[model samples]
Target chain A: MANTHISYTALPGRSRPYFGVLYLVELVFTFGLLAIGERTRLYLGPDHLLVLRRRFFTETAHRFYFSDIQAITVQRTTNAVTANAVLFLLCALTLGVLGLYPFSGGMILLGDFSFGEELLLILACAGFGLGLALNILLGPACVTELITAVSREPLPCLSRWGTAQRALALLVPRIETAQGVPSPEFLNVQPVLAAYATPAGRLITQPPITHDSGRLHELLFGLYLLMSVSCMIDLTGNWMIKNAFDSLLFMIVLVLSCIALLRQRHSDIPSDIRSLTGFALGFSVLLFYFTRPFTMLHMFWNMPENFDPAILMSSMLNPDDPLYVAYVGTQLAVDLFVGLLGLLGIYRFRRLYRLAQHNAALDTPPPPASNVEEPPAAP
Target chain B: MSTALTAWSGTACPRCGREMERLPSNSVEPRVCPHCKTSFIALLFPAAVQNEFLGRYGEPLREESEAACFYHADKRAETACDRCGRFLCALCAIDTQDKRYCPQCLENGIRSGELPEFQSAYPRHDLLALAVACIPLMLAIPILLIVLPWATDIALGFALGLLLFPAFVTAPASLYLALRFRKTVTHPLGRRAGWFPLTVLLAAGQMVVWAVAIIVFTGSLFSEF
Candidate 1:
């Protein structure tokens, strides 16, 4: 009923750029991968909201009409974000000061910091300082979601507190003009209205669908197993045929993990499992991207005069090579920790899912027992 | 058309769909989700409480002269479908009290995009053109520098002799894409402004860089000769 084709640019909302915490790292490492971060923009129209998301050379636009919108949910999420900022800032300051051991005139740190340690400390300081800057720039994190008749989605690039609030100030007025506020009496009578609308036989309630992510859990666990094992093998890795195989395996595992993550998005996976899986996936991708350039440049920098594949392999993976040992050792440690915990989570999830199934089956008539592989019973 | 499908009694967790502790309408304070511990402020509107009107049942025909419904032979015909002339009972009608159509006609209308109000998604090729104009050159430089080992040595001469292959290839394609989508409308709310020229300019910039590099290399070669 209202004019829908005018930009509401007069709304003085200062939206902060949000580079997703996990993705910010990926962007720095991979560089030019998918134009991530502040590329997601929200344009306010007179009667609709346009969320324009830019990814690489393509753009996706999601539009929501004001008249059709039913609710706006805003969640405060600053605690974790603030905590992370402080942690990064403190770590940066500490590591940076430690790196200044030579310049400190033997005053700050009692023990000697080796050249390698100094280099690592400085890099760590830079990394943490970058993290601190990004966190501050991201502003106080908040999740604001828009719910219409058909879909409920978070507003892209409106994660900051000040921005979302100002945007809402602009939005609520337009929405109010479109949809008038109901009487208090009318608001209280919703339950009675729903009761009256339903026909007699058609109103019978159906059992809620069970949240079964058993197969997905098992699949992810299997991939993690492969990833951990590959990492272990790479601990002593040469640039052999097997190293290529391991690379292929890691690629496969990453792809499958992404698939699993997508599938488990709307499912009722526990929060702990979801958080841990997300972290592990993000860390692995970050590590992969960060290490790849150095490895390439290292190989080219030390290119043999009489180039031979065998000689290159030996040089790249020489027992005395600190680079190989350090990278592989770090990878192994992370893989072992996350992979084992994830496996435990999978086992626990499967056991719980089975228990739920078993309980749900109790209400129905017992079926004849079949020779299926029984999983280890939950304690 | 009806608000019943959109309505829910209490707020559900956005992360996990468990029903959270209910708060008063437009409460300033946040309610933390019991399961996930995510704090939320739900601004419930009047639509949440609005009653839905269900479809009316078709009346049974009592007289012989009464027009029979196409779907239900025993019921009296309520109205004719707008798209097709088939008689429809009250139950068989699609859409709100607005446009009247049979189920088949409504389905066809949605799929054919004849009803623009029902369609929300349409791609913007003009935006794609601009993105194509700039992204490739940025991606090419860092990767080529490292992989080819040509940042600062004698290899720098060789690197200069050969302009970035990605930029050379993409420049023409970007220009073509820009020109093709030059007249396409991008933003619905904004005034008609052309960004294709900007895209063309970016492509031209890449071309100029490639030209400069080529000229320098050729000049160096000719001077050496």
Candidate 2:
């Protein structure tokens, strides 16, 4: 049980390597493969295994690297696995549809990433991410699903009349059953009237008020999934889209990612919160790149009509130009939001870790019972 | 009113005072008087409130769910009988979710030594329950077939295969195991857990793995296929 306790002080130093490795490997491997393929004009097999292997390796590497994550909550693990499987299953089908592209299959139009190779790579990455998510979420998902399912099922025999009535009903079980009416000897009028204020009875009278905070973490999780998927889509499709559209798409993805991170920072997060964090950092680069094009456009839009088109096109943009300044400012703002959200997310996760530790301390058992009662007879 | 005992200035009676501890009482209901061994009325907390108070005050109170013995009316059982609702104290709880018992009765029928006691409630969903749960998965198959095509077929194929696999593998294995041990060998969850999920995982995992593998081994595995 103590192993489940998450200490805030120990969390910050642990996840960095996994994040760094995924980032570096994706950057080098994705761009390197693309460069080689583009320069050589080579088509890997219609089914690319090497690219998929790299992705699997990079993700699996993190399992050992972050094995310190001790107890995975049941609900979270299940949700993660189920959601991941569903998404990957969707992605695989989508790519398989894309495989029909050369055959002029009408289904290929769903995604903008048209190059067979690029489409395949993007799908591979999405699938691997989904798999890792599924593995982590499976154990917890089963528990949550079981608990949630059981909680909703009604117990036919545990009647509202309370245990005392049930006990008496047990004494003359045949007569009561034969009569097809509730036993009168078991009724207690006074306690039933007084039960409105009793703890055991109050549950029947009062509706529980669920604070929205319980759901905020999950909502944030959903948003994270959307942003991550969108970013993957945009990154894969980047070569096919106009620069302006790419920048806009990237910014939207980044902004959405930060918003999710900010919400996660303020909630009682599950372990997958680390995954969300890693995803946010990966998209941050795309966000910054998106802003780069916007900064250039801002300068282009601000230029005087008389200004030479050559000078404007020659350089990225004049740094002192108002348009350039505006573009840079907007980019800076996005960067700052991402950074701030990351910091706050880490801080909240740490607090949660500490709280988990504190709770574990409270569950300590008392020493063994003295003069214990004999075990009761089996019914 | 037992005034003679009160008049003794709270002194312990030499005969039974040590054996009979003075427990708190309620005037509305009856209680045994420590000194007189007689039922008497006194102002005291109600049973429900008394239990709560004892719980707060760190006193051990009776468990609300204590099982009672099937044959013995006076005896309270520690565990529930798997066959009947009777409480089998420590001695009778059974762990079979097989044909012999439903969950409530199964809790009663098993021997205490056979089943592991869980301190924290381990919520169980039996084969029937698991089957009922697959209702959603059952519903999901068509939707997935429509929505997610490529690898879902593989999963759908496996789900179909499970029906045959159990008949082919489980039936034969059960017979083989019975001959050796002279008892049945069955693992319900294990037999099905891997196939459905592993199909989904492998379908998805393969898509990612194979695609990347082919791309990385671009020169080696690159074909128009």
Name the top lDDT candidate: 1
Candidate 1 lDDT by residue in tens digits, A116-228: 44454566567667776766765666777776544556665667666777777777776777787544554344321122112122332223323655576566666666766
List candidate 2 stretches off by more than 4 Å.
A1-79, A82-90, A93-97, A105-246, A264-379, B1-225
lDDT of 1 at A164: 70
Fraction of the real A/B interface contacts present in each candidate? 0.24, 0.00
Cα lDDT for residue A83, candidate 1? 42
Model 2: how far is A37 from its true place, Å? 30
Docking class of 2: incorrect
Encode model 2's per-residue lDDT on B1-225: one tens digit a residue: 111111110112221222233333211223343432323221111111111221111122256454445544445555554445554543334444342333444443233323322111211222222222233334444444333433466776665554332333333333333234322212211122222333333234434544575577786656544
Q: Could you tell me which residue pairs clash in candidate 1?
A: none
TM-scores for every predicted model: 0.55, 0.19
- Give one digit per residue, the lDDT tens place, for model 2 in A1-379: 2112222111101111121234334334342211111110111121110001122111110111111111111111123333443345434433443354445433211223224334344555565555555344422221100001001111111111122122223322222233223222221111111112221232223222111132433444344444444444433333324445645755665565566555543233443443445444453563354445534444543554767765544333334333333334434443344345544555665576678679988887765787667698999
